[model samples]
Target chain A: MKLFFGEIYDDHAILNEEESHHFAKVLRGQEGDVVHVTDGKGKLAKVEINSISKKVVEGSIIELKTDFEKKNYYLHVAIAPTKTMERLEFFLEKATEIGIDEITFLQTFHSERKNIKIERIEKIIQAATKQSLKAYLPKVNDLTKFNDFIKQDFENFTKCIAHCEDDIVKTPLKSILENEPNKILILIGPEGDFSRDEILNAEKENYKGISLGQQRFRTETAALQAVFAIDWELKS
Target chain B: MKLFFGEIYDDHAILNEEESHHFAKVLRGQEGDVVHVTDGKGKLAKVEINSISKKVVEGSIIELKTDFEKKNYYLHVAIAPTKTMERLEFFLEKATEIGIDEITFLQTFHSERKNIKIERIEKIIQAATKQSLKAYLPKVNDLTKFNDFIKQDFENFTKCIAHCEDDIVKTPLKSILENEPNKILILIGPEGDFSRDEILNAEKENYKGISLGQQRFRTETAALQAVFAIDWELKS
Candidate 1:
C-alpha cells in the first residue's frame, strides 16, 4: 500500500495539497482505495479513501498505529552546509533515511554556504521518511551560527565535534559512541573545516573532539558518516 | 602542491593528456615547479616539472613515497547499478573518497540497469581518488552476472551479502566484522533487491547474510552504507 502524509481531522484524515495531488493524479488513487497515512508525528493510520481531489484527499481511518519504529536514542547533527546545494540536500535525504532525529545547518567560521531553505529541507526529510517506510519525521532546524549555537545548552546530550585538524587529540567516533548516550549531538565542519577558535570554543563548552576516520571526507559525507556511525553504534 | 596522476619512467614521470592539460592550463604549472604525482599503484612522488605541453607534461622525480595510506583490510563491494546513472556515479565517487579496494557492477535478476559505461565510472573514480589525495586507485571491474560472480572463489576473504528479505536470518554487519577478516567482499543488491534464488545461491557459496540497518535504504544509499560500515568496522 502507498503511504500518504496527512493530518487527522476527527474520524478522517486529510492529505496536504502536494501529497493529495500525488495520490489523486500521480498514483491514480481513487475513492474507496486503502492507503497508509503518516501524520509525521508518530502516527500511522490505515485509511480508506472517501474522496480524491487535487486540493485534498479525504480518508476514513480504519486502523492506527502509534510510535511506530521508535528508537531508543536520539541523534542530532549540526553541520555546515556544503558549497553546493545538492550535496546538502543529498545529506538531508540520506540522513533522514538513515534515521536521524534532528539536523541543524551550522554557520561556522569556515562555512562556504551560510544560508539554507528550511522548508525545502523539511520536504526532503518527509519524502525520505515515507520512502524508507519510517514513522518518525526528523526535525530540520534553521541555520544557526556556530558562536550562538555553542552558547545554547544541551545539558542532557553527549556532545562531540568532528574535525580534521591534527593538533587536537581526537577520539574515534566508535570509541565515543561505545558509552551509548541516549542523546547525541555531533558537529561537522565545512570544506575549509572548522576554524581553530571554533573548535576551542566547542571544547570549552564540553564538546568532545572526535574523528570520523582517516580519509578526508567532504562536508556532506562527514555529516552522513556521523549519522551512520551513531546509528551503527546504537544498533551494535 | 597539487597532485597529478602519471606514469613513472626511469627517473622521470609523464602525465597523461588530461593531466597535462590540467597542469599547463588549469593550474598554470610551469617548468621547474614542484608538484606531487601518484601512479595510482600505492606510489606517491614529489617531482619537478621538467617540461609542460598539452600532450604530456614531463616531471623529474625529486622524492618518492610508497604505500602512503595503505589500509590493513581490503573492501570490494559488488552492487547493481542504480536506474538513475547519477546515483551510481555518486556512489562510486563517495566510495572512492571513503576508500575501497575494488568495485564490481553486478547484473542481478531485478537490476534496473544492465549495462554501464565503464570508462565514465573509471573517470569518476580517478577524479575522486585525486580529490581525496589518496595513493591508491580503486579498481572498477566489468559487470558480472550474479551466478558467475557467486561461482568465483573468494579464497580466505570474508564474503557477505546484504539483503532486505525479512524471512532470512541476517546478522548485523558490525557483529560479523567483529571477527576481523583481513579482506571483505560485500554484495549489495539492486533497487528491487535480489531475488530469493540469488540470495539462496549466495548463501550456498558461504556468503554470510548481513543487514546494514533497519531502514529500507535506496540502492545508492545502501551501497554507501555498506562501504561506510566496512570502513568503520575495520577502523574500529
Candidate 2:
C-alpha cells in the first residue's frame, strides 16, 4: 500500500497536488485501491481510493490509527546555511531521518549565505520524510537573525551552542542527553564561525558552550553530528 | 597556513604546479608565510614560503610532525553513487569529516548512475581534509563491477554486508564495533539493493549479514552512520 501525507477530515479527503500526481500517474492507483495517508500531525488513516486524477485524488477513510506519542524529547538546531544549498539540504535530510523535531536558519555574523530558499528546503524535507516513513514533519522556521532567535523564550529545554574557539569552555554533548529532557536545542555556527558578540549573546541567553569533539567540521556536518550524538545519547 | 597533499618521495619537496597555483593565486601565499603539507600517508610537514607564483610556490620544510595513527580499525564502504552529483559530493565531504578510510562505488542491480567525475571528487576530498586538518586522505576507488570487487580476498578483517531484507542475520553493527579487529570492511547495497544471487555470493565469500539499525537509511547516510558508529564504539 502506498502512503501519502495530507489533511484528514470527516472520513473523506483529497491528497495534495504532489501526492495526487504521484498516486495517479506514478503509482497507478485506481478506485478501491488501498492506501495510507497521514495528516503529518500524528494521524494515520487507511483509505480506499474513490477518485484518481493527475489534478486530484480522493479517498474514503477505512480506518484511523493514532500513534502513541513517543517521548517528548525534541532536537532543534539553529545554524547558518552553507554556501552550497546541497550541503544544507543534506543536513536537513539526514537530521530528519535521525529524528529531529524542528530546525531553524540563523543569519550569523560569519555566515556565508544569508538567504535561504524555503520552498526548496521544504521539498527536501518532504522527500526525506517519505523515504524514512516518518509521519511527523519537522517544523522549519523561516530565516531569522541569530540574536533574535537567541532571545526567544525556549524555556524547559537544554540550550547549547557548538563552536571551535580556542577556549577551555568545553562539555561533551552526551552529558546533556543523559539527563532525559523533553526538549533540547543546539546551535551550530557557519564556516567562519560565530562572532565574539554572538557567543556573548548566546551565553547571556543561557546557551551553554559546547564542542562536537575535536575535529573541525563543516557547517552542515557539525549540525548533523550534533543531531546524531544527541539522538544516540537519548536512546542509550 | 596553506595545506597540500603529495606523493611519498615529494614529502619534503616544494609544492607542485596545481598545488602551487592554488597556494599562490587561490590562497594568496607570500614570502615568510607558513603552510602545512601532507604526504597523504600519515606525514605532515610545516613549511615556510620562499617564493610564490601561479606555476610554482617555493617553500622549505621547517618542521615535520607525525601524529599518532588512527585506531587500528579501518572502514571501506562500497555504495552506489546517488543520482545528483552534489549529493554524492555530500557523501564525500561528510564521510571524510567523520573519518572514513576508503570509499568505492559499485554498480548494483539498480544503480542509476555509472560515470563519476573523479577530479571533482578529489577536489571535494581535498577541501574536506584541509577543513578537518587531517593528515590522512581517504582513498577513493574508481567505480567497479560489484562482483569483480567482491571476489577479491579480504584477509584478517571482519567483512559484513548490510541489506534491507528481513532475515536471520545476527551480525549487529554495534557488536562488530565492540569486537572490531585491526581492519573492518562494510559493504552497503544500492537503492534497489542487492539481488538474491548477490547476497548468496557474498555469503559464500564469508561476508556476514549485518543490520545498521532499526531505521531504513539512504545509501550515503548509511555509509556515514556506519563510520560514526564504528568510530564511536572504538573511541568508547
Candidate 3:
C-alpha cells in the first residue's frame, strides 16, 4: 500500500508539500490513483486522487479510520541530546519505528541540542513513520531545560531517569514491568549523565533512577532501549 | 581508559593494522602510554606501550582479564541481508554493542549478500565493540545459503524464524523467554521475508516461528529487535 503523510478533513485530504511533490513528480501519480494517507494523529484515510498538480495533490477520501494500529500504551521519552545530531536523529528514527508517542530533547548540564534543526528532525521522524507504516507520528518537542522540564506533573506515568551514576540505587526497567504500567516516560541523560542535583531533583518528584542494562550504551542507544523496553514488554 | 581491538598473547599484545594506525597516528600514541586491548575473543589486556611504529604498536601486557563483562547468554542471528549495505552494517554495529555472539548472512532466495565486503563489516562491529567497552568481539560468518545454513546443528538453542507469513501460528519472542533460554538463534528474513519452503525447512528442524512485534519492521530493524529482545530479557 502506498502511504503518505497528509492533512485530513471532513471528506477530502491534501498531501503535504513533500508528499505532494513525491506523488506528482517522483511517483508520477495521477488522477484515479488510490493511496492511503495518514494524519499522524492515529487516523488513516484511503483516498482516490481527484486533483493532481505540481504543488498540491488533493484526493477524495474513500474511507476514513481512526485509531489505526493503536497500541495500548503511551511512551514519552525525554532524552539529553547527543554531541552529534546524527545519534539523536537515529534515536528519533528508531523510536518512531518501534512505537513511541512523544519525544523531548532534555537540555542537561552536559549536553544540549543547541544547533538542532527541528525541521530536519521532523523529516527524519516522518520518514521512519512512513517506512514503518505507522499512522500516529511521535511528537517531537523543542529543547527543554532539565530543571524546567522536570517540574511538569507526571502523576499518572511511570517517570524514570536513566543515569550512569553509580552511588544512586537504580532499578531495572523489567522490575517496573511487573505491574504492567501502560503510560511510561523515561528521561535518558547525556554521556556524562544527569548531574547529581539533577537526579536528586527528579527523585524528589517521584522519578525513579533506572538502569537499562550492564552494558554502557551510548546516549541514543539508552533512549532506544527504553522505547523497546515498553513496546516489547507490553505488546508481548 | 582507551580500549582497542587487537591480538592478545601470553605477555604482549599487538594492535590490528588499522587500530595500530589509529593509535600511532589518530590518537598519537607514544611509548609508555597505557591502553587496553581486546583480542575480540573474550580476553582484555591492560597494556603499556613499549614498542611503537607506524603500522605496529606493540605493548607489554601489564594485567589481563578474561571473560570481562561476559554476558550470560549467546545470540547467533542468521539474517537475510538487506538490499542496502548500510542497513546490514547498522545491524552489525548495534548487535555488537548489545552483545551478540555470532552473525551469519543468510543467502536467501529473496535477498543475498552478494556484494557484502566482510572486512568492512568486521570493522564496523569491531568499532562498536570498542565503543561499548566490550571484551568479546562478535564472530562474523561468511554468507551461507539458506538451505545449507539451516542444516547446521542448533540442538540446544531456542531457534526461531521471524517471517511475514501469517499462516503460521507465530509465537512472540517474549513468550519464549519464559524459561530464560541462555542461547538464542533467530533468523530474520529480508524485506520480502522468507520463502514458504525456507520457513518450513526450519520448522522441520524444530525452529519455531516467532514474531518480533506487531510493527512491519524493516529487515535491519527486525534483526536489531531480536538482538534487543534477548539482551533486554536476559539482562533484567
Tell me the whole-model lDDT of each prediction, alpha carbons only.
0.88, 0.79, 0.88
Tens digits of per-residue lDDT, candidate 3, B1-236, equal 88988899999999999889999999988999999999888899999999988889999999999998888888899988899887787778878888799999889988845657888888888788888888998989988999998999987998999987988889988889877998889999987899999999999988999988887798988888888888887864
Share of native interface contacts present in candidate 1: 0.95
Runs in model 2 lying further than 4 Å from the true structure: A17-30, A52-56, A68-72, B7-12, B24-31, B51-56, B68-72, B115-117
Q: Write down the C-alpha DockQ for each prediction.
A: 0.86, 0.47, 0.76
Tell me candidate 2's interface RMSD: 1.4
Q: What TM-scores do the predictions have?
A: 0.95, 0.88, 0.94
Sort all candidates by lDDT, best to worst: 1, 3, 2
Put down candidate 2 lDDT per residue, B1-236, tens digits, no spaces: 65786432343447767888777788777888888877776778888777776686777777777753464567788888887776678788888878878888888777889888778888899888877878888898888888887888888878888887776464768777767555888888877777777877888888888888766788777877777777656653
Clashing pairs in 3: none
Docking class of 1: high
> For every model in order, what is the iRMS?
1.0, 1.4, 1.0
CAPRI quality band, candidate 3: medium
Ranking by DockQ: 1, 3, 2
Task: Tally clashing residue pairs in candidate 2.
Answer: 0
Where does the lowest 10-residue lDDT sum fall in candidate 2 chain A? Answer: A65-74
- Name the candidate, 1 or 2, with the larger lDDT value: 1
The parts of candidate 1 lying over 4 Å away from their true place are: A9-11
Q: Give me the candidate number with maximum lDDT.
A: 1
TM-score of chain A of 3: 0.94
